[model samples]
Target: MNLADTIAAVATPPGDGAVAMVRVSGRRARAIAAATFRPSAGKPLQPRRFTHGFVVDAATGTVVDEVVAAWLPAPRTYTREPTLEVTCHGGRAATAAVLQAILRAGARLAEPGEFTLRAFLNGRIDLAQAEAVRDAVSAPSADAVAMAVAQANGSLSRVIREVRDPLADLGARLEGSLDFADDGVPELDRGTARAVLEAAATRVDALLATAGPGRVRRHGLRVVLAGMTNAGKSTLFNALLGSDRAITSDEAGTTRDAIEEILPVGAAAIVLVDTAGWRPPGEMPVGEAERLSGARTDASIPLADVVVHVVDGTAPHHATAGRERIAALAPGGAMLEVWTRADLHRGLHAGNQVAPGDQFRVSAITGEGIQALRSSLHARAVAGSRGAGSDSGGELLTNARHVDALRRAREAIDRAMAVVAGAMPDDLLAADLRAAVAACSEVTGEMIGDDVLERVFRTFCIGK
Candidate 1:
């Protein structure tokens, strides 16, 4: 935690690879590098350029590993401190030995996310950008990667500032009017102040609107396939995934547990879950295995964002009962009714049945209506992530912390607008505006506390 002390850590992942990196930062970084590394050309280390060298023990002069090292001077480095990076042949022992030599020469191991924390503390990047770095590193899909990269480049920060700056200027005006009223300074105009407050609130609302899609993009949509036994759930699951991940059979209760796979659809991913078929308990004498399978299906159905209720195309009588069961299980989730074995249905009577939601007739064996179902799933995924009022294509409020902060800011702004409408004192108006500004500052890390910093950075891996 001490900024004056030098820190070092293995920056690469712990595994065997072609190469690994050890990073050092602080005033003593260059000194530690010099003590442990000897340049192959026998020259002093130069700034910003990689030099071939050998890392050795200072006491025994025994070689540890051959490396390519770089020295970066203060004021231009990631932490705005003198920095050193060494690339060595990769393996657990070689990477550990290089880091150990640096530690022996005088460098403490960095705490989790300490490197990015230093970058924030040194004014190289804001708090939002720091969080974005973690998101980019751990993104699950290509779309997620692009979104995280945009956020790290300050897309969200720019949006916050755009909404915050005008309110700040208005607050300053209010303060000036209160402090210098006797010196003939102009009093604030209530109408203009109200307009500004309203505009700022609108912008904050727009940001909040993105939170739903942002969450869906960050964590994929959960879509569960539920149906009666032998209703072709496993076959359709394989057809959707384009692979035989689930065991399909004519036997009832073949799937005893939920099987899950991820299907990428446009800018979002669908977590497709195939649950065990449900059978009414009293209709047939049930065994313990059948009870467990039904329990798992019940558990998975309620948690899904979309529950696909599969019905056998040949059995027209079971459709009403299936719909009732699905409604009872997933009352709040979106429902899609699918009739399997379209190839076997010779007439339109079964397919024309009235359904509450979307209905699709699909034949997993013949590939009939599969593409249409896939398209529907993709549309639902994209609709959930749409950036409603935002002009920035992919910029969204993905983190819950960010959404909460913005909500607080919007509430504060709403209070300020009410104070203006009531013709309240300038001091009261200024206080609310200041509160709004502080809330926005918290998002960018300009006015955050140590506890919040610890919570945010602790999620990051060490040497970040």
Candidate 2:
């Protein structure tokens, strides 16, 4: 965790490519590379300059490989260290060769996420921005990338700090109201307290409201396929994913657990889940899988960025509008409706249109209307979290951990507001306010725990 020691790693991903990169940080980074590199143009790489060189093994002083070297001087680089980046031919052997050279030159091999970890360990960034570094790399979609870039550049951190500072100050003011009341110092007026509390509460509540959507944006959108038995949900799922990821059959409960595929969506990706269509609780001992599948679909429904209701329009009308499935799946929400096997019969397609929002007629058998359906699916995936809260124009909190903390803080604040408005003493109000401040502090790493830190960093990809 010490930031002083230099760290080095192959930053680019493994496998064949035009170029792979090895990144090094800390004071000795440049010096170590200088000894192992000889630029064709001149003396070892000039500061803030990139040059062509051949990596020479320090042990034997023999040229091992050709590389393009870039050196970024201290205080002018990521991690605020003397940084060196070497671009070598990309192959499994090339990456290993270059990385081994760097390690042999005295730079320590980096652990997963250690580069960004060092950036945080040093004063180059805060916890929020450090976390954003991973998001930028692991971006699932363009919208997620945009939000991550904003946070990495400090937009999100600024908002969180602005929110945190006032909450911390309010906690002190409440404590002061209790401590200085005995000293005859004028306590915080009821009007002033309410104004501050309400404003802070509103700011937090606004961020919390977007938490659900923001999470969906970062994590690929989840689109669940639901319909009655043998309704061709699996067929559409396979077609959309461009693979036979789901098991399709004429049997009623063939798809027991929900099957999922990661499909590349517009500017991002989405997980299309094909679930067992609702069937009466098992009578022929066949309903166990069906019941479990329905229960899981119901559980995942609330988290869905969109729900695609697929049905075999040719099948007999079981319930008008499939109300039970809609009620069980979406409840008080809206989802896309699609009629599969639209080419089966003319009369079948007639009663298929769900109307209102978006309804599509497609045939998994023939390549009919699939392109349009894909476009619709793309729109839903892209619109995500921002679809509902189009008006709020500030940075949003996307971390579920942060959201849970904020929700707890808001509850404590609400309790304090009630306490101040009624029978409780100012001292009691101070305790609640302190609890709220502690919860908010955890988000900013102000007064957090090591376990929480490990959990956050553990989610990051290796060599971040």
Candidate 3:
């Protein structure tokens, strides 16, 4: 973790592949590479351009592996420090040998996220950008990747800094008024201060609105299928996923555990879960497995972002009770009613007893209404994102820490607005504005604490 030491690590993921890379960063990166690597053409290694080379054991001068090395000098590299990357033939022996040779040449193994921490320390990137690197690497869906890329490109940092700028300016003006009392500088009136603070609060509100959808898109929405035994939850799950992911059977209580799958609905991803059939504890003539299955189904309801309560269209009332139970346990506005076996319905409107407008009627057997249901799910997922009401295309705040920081900034601005409205002293308004600026700075890492930085970078994988 020492900032001054040269660090090296295998940048590519573990295991055999077409190629692998070893990354080295710090002041001694170039020197270590020069010691362990020899150019194929017997020419001196140049900066920024790749050179075909052989990685050699420093102690014995034995060629370890064939590699292509690139040396990048400080102030323009990723860490704003001297960096070297060696791409070698993919395999455990070759890559590991090359890395060992680099280590023997005076480079220490890098700690988790050390490269990115160095980038942040050297001012090549800020806190938000550092976080974005992790997000981009671990993104589970396309939407998540897009959001991460935007933040990595400084979208979030720019937004935070820009919002803080006006507040900082207001604080400077208030200080000027206080210091130049005898010079007759016009002091900021409560009305003007309130107006400025309110405008800033509105911007914060806009950013905060993206937190929910950002989280949903980042981690994906948990959509669980729950209903009475033999209600076709497994069938519906398989139908939605377009594969036989879950075991479907005609017998009741066949599904004994929750089967989870990642299903992309438009740009958003849904963590679709198929839970065991719901049954009253005493009503089921079952063993320990069935009891546990019921308990799991019950437990999954509350955690789901959207619970698709499936009921048999042939016996809609039988599922009504289960639907009500799930709705009670699920988060508000998170339940979607689905009536299965729509193909078997024979009565008016295909034996659809429930009101036609409120629920989605689907038939797993015939694939009827499946695509419509997917489209509806996709639309609902999109609505959960920040730009639901407009085409603003603003950056969504995906990080929980960033959202919390924005909330704090918004609260500070609110306090300043309230103080101004109360005709409080200009110094009090300035203090609140300063607090707001500090909160915003946390997002950009301007005034961040050591503990926060440690926690942020620790989540990153080693060799990042």
Candidate 4:
């Protein structure tokens, strides 16, 4: 927490704009800026003041750029250290010059996520709030921004505290019960402990449920469209995107690669991908066109969070020998059987079984069942998040790490619960409870070490 090294970075997004921000944070932040900063007005780097200045090099003293430096002196700033943010002319060269001058004046380049990490270490924010800062910065939509802002302001930290507080108290009491057992007094009643554990477990479950929705707000959904070429796949893509992104042609196999676009589906943007149509298994794929198309289609299938299998309404199901093929190649995903070109098959329709084991529908042209399809898609992607919708009806694990930790925790807790029920001894119950607590701690990084932090941050881009 005693960081003498000042960290600086261009905080604004990299681009040409009217203005950009260069941020500096740490104990020596003001001094580092003073080395290169030539302020023209206001109380000079005082406790609180914004000064107009021409940032310059310390040695030769050449001007870098005109900037507004506002000082938020020690312990009362982000990172709980003295901080200075310079608003400079927006451009690659001007922004770079200001930051370079700060660096030349002795500020170290901040590592990706270092500023937030420093904030965490200095107690200005918790891990969750620190993470919320990143989410808030990278928010794509207004809703996500609002949610991230709420979280950064400590909504999730409060919820986490509400759930984690009792557990911590229970843990302390349990430890006390063991330590002072011979004193003839119990710190926590057995029944009360059971009730408290159950309540904590229930709260964890609710939080786990909300995690999906939270991630959805952070990352948009993935919706992929697949079927035989000329099944009106491009038309459907055009309809959803409200633009002609993919070329429409009557020729079969017109599309040979995956085409993805963001479509506004309710409050969230769903990434819709139109893949190369599913081809017959051994159709003597004679050229690069055939091979690449098939490969891309196969690759796209596994990548889909949800699949919309387009079935040509005008074609006989058995003629192309594909109804069974499409069913067999269901891609292990949330699928919707779509009967495309429904306008051409109104009277002749005999209620198709296009998606034998999934929901089937009709239309690409003439808008024959698009609304129903929209509703189905909406049901699949809840509020702009990735993965499956809410009704997937299973405690579907969200984070792979959480899933692994909770699986271990569940087993440990179950063992402890059994032992507490007198099915096993108290000593065994206590040990199992400790193990469960350790497992739960993993999810919150309580049991994590420096190596894990290194691994986590290494995956992040620098200057985060």
- In terms of TM-score, the best-performing candidate is 3
Which stretches of model 1 miss by more than 4 angstroms?
228-261, 274-303, 310-322, 325-332, 338-372, 390-394
Position 424, candidate 1: lDDT: 84
Instruction: Report the backbone clash tally of model 4.
Output: 5
RMSD of 3: 3.0
Model 4 TM-score is 0.82
Evaluated at residue 428, the lDDT of candidate 2 is: 76
**lDDT digits (tens) for residues 1-464 of candidate 3:** 68899999998898999999999999898788879989999997899899998999988999999999998988798888899999998898888998999999999999889999999998889999999999999886788889888889898888787788988988999989988978999887666777778778877888888777788878778788999888888999999999998888988889998989988876778888999997633466378999898888889988887788787778755765775687577636467778889889853222233345446888987898788878877776666654543322377878899989889999999889888888878888888888999999999898998999999988999889
Cα lDDT tens digits, model 1, 11-125, are 8999999999999999999889879999999987999999998999977889999999999999898888899999998999999999999999999999999999999999999
Ranking by TM-score: 3, 2, 1, 4
Please give, for residues 347-423, the per-residue lDDT of candidate 4 as tens digits. 32333543453544456556666776777676556633542333322222223455466566657656656665665
User: Which is superior by TM-score, 1 or 2?
Assistant: 2
The alpha-carbon deviation from the true structure for residue 438 of candidate 1, after best TM-score superposition, in angstroms, is 1.4
User: Which has the higher lDDT value, candidate number 3 or candidate number 4?
Assistant: 3
Residue-pair clashes per prediction, in order, are 0, 1, 0, 5
Where does candidate 3 have its weakest 10-residue lDDT segment? Answer: 346-355
Root-mean-square deviation of Cα positions for candidate 2 versus the true structure, in angstroms: 3.5
Q: Against the unseen true structure, what C-alpha lDDT does each candidate score?
A: 0.87, 0.76, 0.84, 0.68
